[model samples]
Target: MSVELEFEFEGILYSVVREFRGKAMSANAKFYKNNSLTTTGAKEVTSAIIKLTKMSKDAFMHTLFASQKELTSLSTLKNEDRKKMIRKLLGLEKIDFVEKELVEKSRELKREIEAFREVLLGEDEIKLKQEQIKESVTVKDAIAKEVLSKNEELEHIKLRERSIKKELELLSKTKEQKQKLFSELELAKNSKSSEILNQVKLSAELHQLEHKQEELKKLEPVKAEYTALQDQIKEQEKLKEFHLKKEGILKEQTLLREQYTKSKTDINTLERACEGYEEFVLNAKNLELNIAVLQESVNAKHTIENELKAEMAAEQKQIDITNAKIAKLHELGSEGACPTCTRPLIEEYDNVINSLVTVVNETHQKKINEHNKQLQNVVTQKAAFEAEAKVKEKEFSELINSIKVIESKLQDLKNAREYFVHVEQKGVKNKEELKELEQYGYDEKLHNGIKSSLTAIEAQYKHSLSLETELKRLVLVKADLENVTKKIEELKATCQNKETEFKLIIYDDVKHKHQLDEHESILKTVESKTALLNEIKV
Candidate 1:
């Protein structure tokens, strides 16, 4: 027959089972504390079970459970509060019947409250409906009084209609006489308007004839100014070839300026790329150091693990040796002979053998537990190191990739520099042309020339075209600069991200290695204690 008992403390559940053999019973139990025992503030439960068969039919197991705290110590609390606390201390299982009763009663009360609330709502609805009916009755009475007053007003309106019909007949006769008088008045007004219009046209013609001489005198100076502007236009035509040559030199200057700016940008980008590569290289070196440390820590864990394995094997060997010795003793004792000497086995030897075996088993069990704990720590350290190494290895690969991209861009920059040399040759020849123009003394003064005004305007148009072309080129160059700036920003962001990730990997790897060292030290202490505990003296 087997019986199981359960205990609960601070929300943690524990159970124990005992088996009875034949008609005899034994009470043997082992307890394991929670893994969070040291960290959490929960109390450990210590329980005792006693089974006694006062009667053969009534065998019962009596269990008494206690904790690190006592409910009786709550003497200063109020009576009800102390009782409530005592109930919580009893825990969920201890007060199962009472809690079920409370839950059922609470549900019944909740249903009763809902029924009462429903009755109150029904009464409120009835009151609201009665108010609405009374208001409808009052509205009906008001509408009835308004209808009666409107009937009296309809009688007065009929009497006024008869008097209006007589007045309308008198107005129709007077309206005919008034219309004839209006027709005569309109004829006189149209005749007077025609006479006034004829007078206004005659007066306007006389005024224009009087002003003709003054207008001719004002035009004489304006005609002379037009003649002078035409002369200035003709003189400016002599410089058309000079202006065209100057336009070419200005175009070359603009192109040279753009190329120079591009060269400066290329130099800056190369410098930054070099710096980024060097920084990443430095980071790679640091990663190597971290990897070395990690490897060393792994080696240390392996050494500890091997030593633990050896210790366990030695314990097993000791157990095997002890068992062999016991077997020999048992065989010799039964045969009534001693294997070491030609004498009978001593009684004292039996007692000594039992004590030795008990000590060996106890020590072996304790050492094995300590060894297992240390071995687990070493395994965990190795696992953590390997995981960090994986990420570090991934980042190192990314760093190499980044370096390759930068190198490719550097090659592109070198090609651009060769293109820049070709542009420089063109710029130098244009600069020489600009010097020649300077020596000949270019003049910008415009003189009036009516004979060549059209040609001068053509020269000005060509200059305007050159100005517009330069403006368009400037806008394109600005857009290109923005694009280059954007590319630089993107490259900067990528380099920064790679550097940060690589550094983080190295930093984390170092931290993991440091933790492994700490674990190794802890294992070393455990090993020392296990060795001391398992030591056997001859």
Candidate 2:
């Protein structure tokens, strides 16, 4: 089964969307980029990311392009009610639809920022960036899946086309040869003269003609067989068509089943993601509460600092040692560290040290003031870093999400690909089975075998024609021989008649001469008798 098609692909490429019984399943891309950079790795990863993001965003733009389903769930509340509920849940303003849009944009920005960070950040920073990367990976996976699906389909089509083309070429060659043979047969008949030969004087020629006539009689059954073969060939062709159609129907059914399975899987995955979204909401709420409590503690501590100054100075000194220990403890959270560093100082040496301690504390305070200003600058820098990190995280997350979508889509495509492969395999099996079906009613091979038998019959028929021609030639030759025999008989009769006439003429001449001789003898006797009688009378 083959189809001829002209494809125009300069502007648009075509591909098949496949299914294995119709279930979605992941497939890997044929080509992968490793240590490869495009757009100088400087043009900011190309607008392709933007295009894909927009495509995804447009799919749910009506829902404010929300990545999570939670926003849609919050949409039902009145503005003030929503504001109060939002503040209670996550310490935020109301769930304005506009806010959803802004949040989505922020997420996109976060993803972009995260990607930049991933590229720039040292190895130690990667642990902090992992969550962002996961998100980005998901998005990348989605696009990869879409591309892979199309490629697989294209490959299948190409393979199928090549196979069909080969079969078509073979058929064409066979058909052409058959036509050529028929043409040559026609040419042989036209060129060969059907004239009968003249009778000859040779007995060997007559014997040869007799043998040829016998050979002609032997060819009659062969001609009948040839005609039968031709009929069988026609019957076989019809069977082939029927089997092919059956194969096509089976292939189509295989594809349908795969599609159904993939849809079910997609629905299940969507449900699972919705549950995860609920968990995210809970975590966001807890973080908001913690931030609020921390702000209050900072305010209370600042207010009480002056009242406890002298006592606080001693306590502060103790607390500073503890603070240093705590920092060291954090640094050594997973390993061994200095334990004596946290112990408070005590003894008589304190008097000499107190003066030195005052000078040191005063200088330390001045240094602290300068450090606080520097810390403020660091804090500002950190905020900017955080902003950038958030954007990167958001962008990366989006990419990861997209990758997940791609992975899921890839799964669907894989399922589709598998389904098609199954369909194709089934089709091939059906064809094979059809061949195996010796049941004359369904088997194409059986029909072809019958056709071959018919062709043999046709060849026999042609032989019969040859025999008939020989028979005709023999009949013409026999008639010429009969005519020659009749002419020879006529010539023999004419020769016998001439011999009889010649005998008659000779006999007549002999009888006439004898009569004349007798007459002459009697006249001579009379004359002698008369002379004797006259002498006696005297």
Candidate 3:
């Protein structure tokens, strides 16, 4: 028996032939691309079909040619096996496994949610804690009030103790004064005889001190003369210092005057050098303006040149297109059709060819000639503008150089003028100061004579000062003797008064200190209670 099959797959035609003679089989196949044979022989044709279809031989056999045994097995399959086979065939087994995993993950998430719910606190417990806090605050407030009352009581006790302490301190001071008075009285009694003997000797010394005082009184005129002479010497020394300062001022004035003259001369020279500053600056500005104008003209010419060149290119392109149409018309003869309209040439062929030739010569070629003329004009204008711009740029550059030189000269002039002003002001100030210094005259001869006389008088005054010091000592000693007698009487009276006052005071320092300690202990106890209350509140 022989069998032949023909089929098409993916735009390719395939053919197969098989012959079987008592289980001795032979097969041949062929495939074609676009009706052209691609592969021959069963194995080569099968491989080509498999590569084109992207399928294996077994898959191809099963998909395209199912066996009778397979059909019978499918009919006899159980429903579960059928479903399993369908799932395997459709690639849905991985989806089933993923679905099962998702279900387990969902159960785990549910459990985690329940566990989290258990760990969270309920609203009622939070309210109970808030109520406890309120009660604690109330108790703390009561304790705080008690502490305030205790503190006030402690303050009262402290004030009373402080008053008592002040009284005790005054009493102690009175006792010390009484002891001091007693000591002074004993000392005065012991020194009484010595003071009497001193009075006798002091009287004799007083007579000698009086003679020294009289001598000092006679030398007072000489001391006055010496003081006047010293004043004159100081005046002369100040005058010498002023003269030296005046000499320095004169030298400075001379230097400043020279600087002023030089600065004035430099300012004049710089001013002359910068004489045409404004004119040169204006020339530079004009040159820059001319250059800018020339540049603008050049740019305008460039724009015109570009436009003309583009127009010329378009015209030339049109001319070439027309010439091509004419050539095409000539080549088409009468039998050919028009390329653009797709019409039969017939009798209009020569007319069409003539029209194209006319367009090339009259229309496109004429436009090209006009564009060329305009382009040449633009080129000429561009060249003229560029040349003028170059000239202007050169002039601007030279003007800028001149402006820079002028500006530098002007700056020097400004600096010199400022320096001249400063020098002139300084010279005027120095001149005024020099005049002031010249007003104070000095006489060196008179100053020397007075200084010599003051030296002699100073020696005499020094001797008188010694005598005067001794006289003052004796006078102070006499006055001390009289004051001592008066102090002794006053001390006896002060002692009596202090003794009475001392007996009147009855302050008990120990008792007052004990009261203060009691108040402090009570304060500490109140503070401790307050601290405990604060802790409970927290």
Candidate 4:
């Protein structure tokens, strides 16, 4: 069914060779007359050839000598060919001019050939044959004319007879067609009447059902409204209950505040009492230090007095021994004897005795003076030591007072610390309780929020529930519409069936008419033959 073509032009000139389905076409110089190496030239040329054959889009012209330099050079050397090649390469040549030239040349050649053939046959020879041809032509014409006239007259009579016969056949077919149409019309009338009665009865039933559906549709909105109102009332009740719970929580908060205030006051009082106890303990410690200082001062005085008495007794014994030595020296001086022999003294012995007595008295005096000076220095040192001891005793008393105050303060501070610790502990316990109560309050509020949200959602749910019911009703309505559509489709099918039957009846009538026309034609042909025989006889 589909033909494909490939065209190739092979030769020294632009001649075309077209191939299709293994069939090849070889065109001569006439084919190359207007072709060129251009898309438009090829298209015009291909179109001209395809008018006589079946060629496809794959048609083209290929020049064999195009790529050969020697042949191209030779083709370029010819003046006319060079001009034509240049025009073709530049796409400036018109194919219409070439096609016109070819047509003119072909006409001129045909005329010239005909003139030469006429010359080859002499005029006398032609005239003799023309006369003979005229005689034969006249005889043939007369016989053919007579035969044609008879045939025409007989054909006319046969046409009239065939016309009458076909008219009779058409009348008969028309009568039968009327009877069949009347019967079909009767069936259609009866069916339409039955259908109309059924439709009336169903319409009444449908109207009653639609009326009940309308009543239900009206009641749906009212029921939905009542449900919504009920949900709102329930939510309001929950809000009231939440408010009461919040009020109770506020009361508990107030009680906790009072307890926190009382605990702080008790802690403050304990701190002040600790300060007073520290002051009392400091005064008692100072008194005990003063008593110890006085006892030490008295003991230092007794020790100094005892040491002075022992020194005075030793000095007295030494003075007594020195006086007895001075008395022995005086008695020895009164004797006046020789110092070495124990005899009565002369002038030299007296001198020696006086010197000895003077030396002993001087030694005794010096010793007494030294002892008194040393005793005075010892008494002064003892008095200074006693004063220093008194100063140290005063310092010790002050230190003891301060230490006792510190110890008493430490004890009071411990008591205060314990009291404060107890209050702080109670405060911590209260803080923990408050924390728990705050958490509980927060949880209650959160729960209330959740309940409110749930109430709101439930109200929304009730509304959506009604919408769902309406959607269900709409779905049912859609189903009814679909059923009505189906009934309409069935009626359309019946109409189509009726139309198809009518078309079949019309086709039968057309076929019978065609057969009658053929029978009339045959009868006309027979009558025409009889008329021709009668004309020949006459």
Of the candidates shown, which would achieve the greatest TM-score relative to the real structure? 3
Clashing pairs in 1: 230-449, 230-450, 231-448, 231-449, 232-447, 232-448, 232-449, 233-449, 234-449
Model 2: ten consecutive residues of lowest lDDT = 26-35
Per-residue lDDT of candidate 2, residues 1-538 (tens digit): 1122222333533221212222454321111123232222212332333343454433334333433564665798889877765554552444465698999999999999988985686776887699789987897787667656656654555555555556555555555655555555444333322211234533345677677668766776665566566566667666666666666756765764675466556656655544444444455555445545544554444444433344445545754765565555556543443354433333323433344456456754555555556555545554554555555556555655655665565566556556656655665666576566445456656766776666555655665566565556566666667776565555455545544543443223454455456555655655565555444334
The segments of candidate 2 whose C-alpha lies over 4 angstroms from its true place after superposition are 1-211, 214-229, 240-538
Full-model lDDT for every candidate: 0.61, 0.53, 0.77, 0.59
Error of 3 at 39 (Å): 99
- Clashing pairs for model 3 are none
What's the TM for model 2?
Answer: 0.23
Index of the highest-lDDT prediction: 3
Per-residue lDDT, model 1, residue 29, is 38
Off by over 4 Å in 4: 1-119, 154-158, 161-194, 197-520, 523-538
Tens digits of lDDT, candidate 3, 437-505? 878877778778878888877889899778877876876867876776666566566656656665665
The true-versus-predicted C-alpha distance at residue 32 of model 4, in Å, is 51
lDDT of 1 by residue, 37-144 (tens): 221111212222221112221122112343435545667789877776666555544567787899999999999998898556577889999999999888867776
Quick one: RMSD of model 2? 55.0
Query: Candidate 1 at 292: error in angstroms?
Result: 1.3
Rank list by TM-score: 3, 1, 4, 2
Better of 2 and 4 by lDDT: 4
Candidate 1 RMSD to the correct structure: 45.3
